[model samples]
Target chain A: MPEPVLELDRLVVRYGSFTALHGLSARFAGGALGLLGPNGAGKSSLLRCILGLVRPAAGTVRVAGRDARRARSEVRRRIGYMPERDSFVPGMSGVRALAHLAEVCGFRPDDAMLRAHDVLHFVGLGEERYREVAGYSVGMRQRWKLAAALVHDPDILFLDEPTNGLDPRGRARMLTVIDRVRREHGLHLILASHLLPDVERLCDEVWVLDRGRLKMADSLERLTAAARGAKRVRTRPEAAAALAAAARAAGLVVADGAAEAELVLTRPEAEVAPAEVFALAASCGAPVLGVRPAARSLEDAFLEALEGD
Target chain B: MAFRATEYERFTGRRARRPVWWPVCTATLRRGWSSRWVRLLSFGALAVAFGFTALFYFAYQVMPNWPTLLRVLGEDEGMASGFPVQFYAGLLHVFVYPILLPLSLLFGHDLVARDLTSNALETYFSRPVSPAAYVLGRTLAYTGFLLLTTLGPMLWIWAFDAATGPQGRFGEIAFVPLALIQGLVPVALVLALFIQAVSSVTRSGVWTNLAVIVLFFFGFVAGQILYEESDRPEVVSVPAASGGRNEAEPAAAAATTPAQAPVPAEETADNGPEPTVPADAPPRIRPDRLPLALLVGAALALVGGDPTPLLLAAPTLLFSGDRQDGRPPAAASAAVGRRGPPAGAGRSADRRPAPASPEERIVVHHDPRLLAVSITEVIRGWCLGCLDRSYPEEVRRAQAGRRHRFRATEPRQVPVDLARNVLLGLGGLSLLLLFARLRRQGTVG
Candidate 1:
């Protein structure tokens, strides 16, 4: 019953003639929220509108119960944004640049400097804090950006493609740092990423967008839990329709699986046994090629959201 | 203590309501002052100030005893007695032209452009600072340095002049500081905004510096060309009056034109009298040319406060060859002493003047000084000359209102002072709008 961290009211964003967000309306309660979409899906545009960078063509965006447009500075003060691109003040040491940004965000000078050092330490840039941010390598710059975002200690954090372009070790390090920040600090998060596993590991809620439309918004728990008691059935491409019909006729909830010629069958009240799935396919004049349990995963939910009407 | 990369720690300290632009201004100052070129130039500016003060002191002390030495140094007879108005004018020229100009170039090239090149504007706007505040902070940083270099030393010299002069000299020259401020502040503010605007366009420090250098070089080159061309005699055709047949009518029509091209005095002396067109003679076809020299001179005048450039620009505007008919006259040297029967000139010849009408005559009068002096210089010089001529008596008058003197006689120098003021005002406004646009596009796009 606390105000949702973000409330978007039929938000419409356009760049010249092209619409980026088509009347998006949603409310995100405070928690780790994952925004999942492919390229040009308006994920970054939505972040920009929330950050007060892009003015909406129509409708309103509210952050923490304040109008994002009217109260932009106040709203921005409570939110830290890690942009998708490599951004930093040139000619400044990493620590000094972070401190300058913190000061810009209204932090006391001494406290800003101390917080800058501490955040750098937290993000594993403590050793390179004295080096110019312009000289930082790809992974180091990513860590430095994360450090900058955290230096202000805002209430909500917006991370745009945080793990982008990172090697395996670097990606793991970034995720670990983000996870620690979210879990230990109890900060609210609105993380926009294309990597679903990264979301699954950190976020409890998800919003899926495709081509400027919000396809689904729900708790990650329920999205994945809906796949429980389901079996993934793979058969010949020609037998897909017959197997799906058979499973539906058996009073099971059936949907398309993530791969070709596959059907996922679930019963809301009970478990869907693989042997039962095979029997249903066999009786319906469909070949029972393979049967396996459909484990809970965000990828299935995400792809389903994209695939759904 | 051993270093450890650990969990994130929240900042628990209190926040302050410091002006958001403070950090930006300070950062700009710090970065610019940290540059080796800027520091070295700053010292050079200081050294120039000291050297000028010493020169003025020595001139006042030694020049009085040796008029011959004063004459050798090109010191007019009046300057040998006391620090004249030229003292302040000379001070402004030395301070702005040599010391502050390059210093500003070195210090200000990267102020805004570096942020753009580094893609830091988004990070800046992502904070609480507005575009206006960002621009203001940058301008303030550059303006502060210029004022420090310009007004700071000028005032020191003025005080030195007041202290070292003969008794009661302070009362005579009390208006010098006011004049310095009136002249210097706008130059500083305009330059600060101008460089930043240039930076926004070029988006690189080195390129913006190059652009500034090119613009100045063009101004210098254009000023020289205008000066040479304006030094020549020009031929122009006067249009006959609409209904009048008297001599005054044509003269009145000619007076309406912005400037009258002067013929060489020798040519006029040899022509015996102003030549009249016979009614039977055919008129020549010619058209009026736009005043290119005046415009170029006015534009170049906006760059400096020394007034010498303005003086140089004025003659070009007034006397540049604007041939109304026939092929462009050969250079100034070739056109002299050629007095032939008048050819049909100007489209106005179609409305043929009656044989008895004096308007049919082509009158040419020449003043040797037109090529050497601009109308603005004439007016400004007249004001300054009046002050210099009346120096012993008009000190009280000068003290009462020397600042308003140029503005009061604005009708005389309209083409010069007005154009300079309008260009400066428009230039400042355009720079402001450019900064806003840069911020708006930078943030979202």
Candidate 2:
């Protein structure tokens, strides 16, 4: 019902003869949308186009219902960007760098300073805010960049590899903060990353890209749904063999593992039901703990999408 | 205390719409001042200012007793009375060369280069700041710093001079501050933008500083070389001979009828009688031939035909001189006066028949090479030497009878005008080029 936060119509970008993005036409709804792509797959280029940092060779980039090329300043005002690189004003303290960026984003000096302090605290750098950015560790630098990006309170936060180069704990902290920003602050988020699990955990929708082309754009729920060929079953260890036999006798393919059994449901999922499985389990005199749709992981879905392209 | 309460709160407070450049300008100024070297240099500038103020105070205290003081110091009376304009000129020279130039170069070397190397330009331009605003902010930062060192001290010295100097002369020198602003502002702006433009292209601060230094000092060195070579004896010999011949025709005719001329005894006593030339000898050249040739060459150079002198003395050309006294150094005055007939030419006509006229009394054999050497010496003295040393011995000879009015013609004024035009043109062109380069690089927003 609401306009998409970012819309690209047949966008094409090139540097000399090497095209970074080719005819990337997509509409990202106003929610968490993960931009999944391998390195050099035009993920950064696409984000740059959406932010109006790079001009599209062909087609249009509309951000918040305005032409990004024509209304660049207005568009940028509505969006916050955390670049993948270590970009910060050198020799400046964390608070000063954030405040400077906030001021450039159209805030008064005092307001910017207050907001910088607030954001630095929010990003878990409250104590280190006074230290120069040069002295900050890699994780702290990432947090500092996030604080600067969020200091302006933009409508859409464009984070390019927000968790890149972070240790496991630091990555978890960053992910948690980003998730909170999206859920609590209620701002549209475009997360660009190569890590599939991070995307699957945080984003509702996923747009997989490969070789400058969009492989698939759909909700994570729909993308990783049951592959329409198998059902996984959980039952007593002694009952797993009997359950597989019953499943086979019921005209479904079955494979038994050590703890559970998987049924290759020859019949469509529309026709198969939990009641049928329960009736079969009773006849076989086996206890059935649970039966659910077996779906591919996000990594599988992403690799499959790229494979199809 | 803890900022926990405000953490993760959206900054919904009303945002203020300030000029985009103000934050950047303030930040740059703060960063620059935070550096220890900048603080030290600023203190040095202040010390120089106070030192000058004290010097002026002491000079004024001894003004009434200048004759006795001059005797005690074994200095000429001219040095005491000629304090206002020349003194300010020396002060300006010291400020620009040693203090302001180095400080500006140091401040500007990293201004843009750091942004580029650290990729902060993306952060800056990704926001509401435009390229023009970025440039304006950075340029203003350097300009502000340079002004603190330059205009601040200059005004301090001017205040001391106005208070200690004669009241009647105050009106004349009152505009020195204005001249300084007009003169130094462009110098500062040009240096700032020029350095910024260079920084935009390179990522190393050392390289940027090197480039700026090379540009400023190399231009000065090259200009000095060109000026020396162009004003050399070989280049002026033929011109001086022709100039001498043109003057000799009228001078020889006056010398022939000595009975009709009844030269005054006082005039003859003051300047020994001019030597008579044999009718078979070549035309005699006046001792002032070399200075005349230099004056002519400098005038022709100003008309856009020749740029040797203009290029060499660019800084001197752009200088507005001490506006308070209205009398720039004599060398500058003479350089500017080149377009008109030579100074004291009219007086030469009236005294020509006297045979011992101060102008004709110093005649020597008209050798083209020798005349060229004379012209070369005068130009070298005026162009490369200090103001006191710039006056040619020929001009000194003519001033022997009227030492009270001696003013060495300053050739720097010619280059000053030329330098202004050249710098303005270069600044405009460099700005355009910088804009285009930034656009092409597409590294901003």
- For each candidate in the order shown, give its overall lDDT on alpha carbons: 0.67, 0.64
User: Taking the tens digit of each residue's C-alpha lDDT, what string does model 2 give over A1-309?
Assistant: 877888989999987678988898998878899999889888888888877667788999998889998898888888898999888897799998998898888888888888888898888998898999988999998998888789899989989999988999999999999999899989899999999889988999999889899999998877655444455667777877787788788877564433434443434333456788888889998887777765547887788788894
Top TM-score hit: 1
**lDDT by residue for model 2 (B225-325), tens:** 53343233232122211112232221111222222121232322123322222212222223222233333334445454344653444334332232334
Question: Judged by DockQ, which candidate is best?
Answer: 1
Q: Give the C-alpha lDDT of model 1.
A: 0.67
| Candidate 2 CAPRI grade | acceptable
lDDT of 1 by residue, A1-309 (tens): 688899999999998789999999999988899999989999999998898888899999999999999998898888888888988887899989999999888888888887888888889888898999999999998898888778888889999999998999999989998988888888999999999999988899999999999999999888877577778888999989988888878899887877999888888747898789878977988987778888857887787788887
How well is each residue in B1-445 modelled by candidate 1, as lDDT tens digits?
Answer: 3335476878787888988888888778888888998888778777877886797688778753342353235434322223355556556667777766787788888777888877788777777777877887877888888888777888888887777766666776677776666556666676777778778767789998998888766654553344333322233323332221222111111122212112123322233554432222222211111134433543554444233654576554444442443322212111122332221111121222223334434343321122212222222323332223233335534433322121111111212222234335434544644455565556766
Cα displacement (Å) at residue A146, model 1:
1.2
Model 1 share of native interface contacts: 0.71
DockQ of structure 1: 0.62
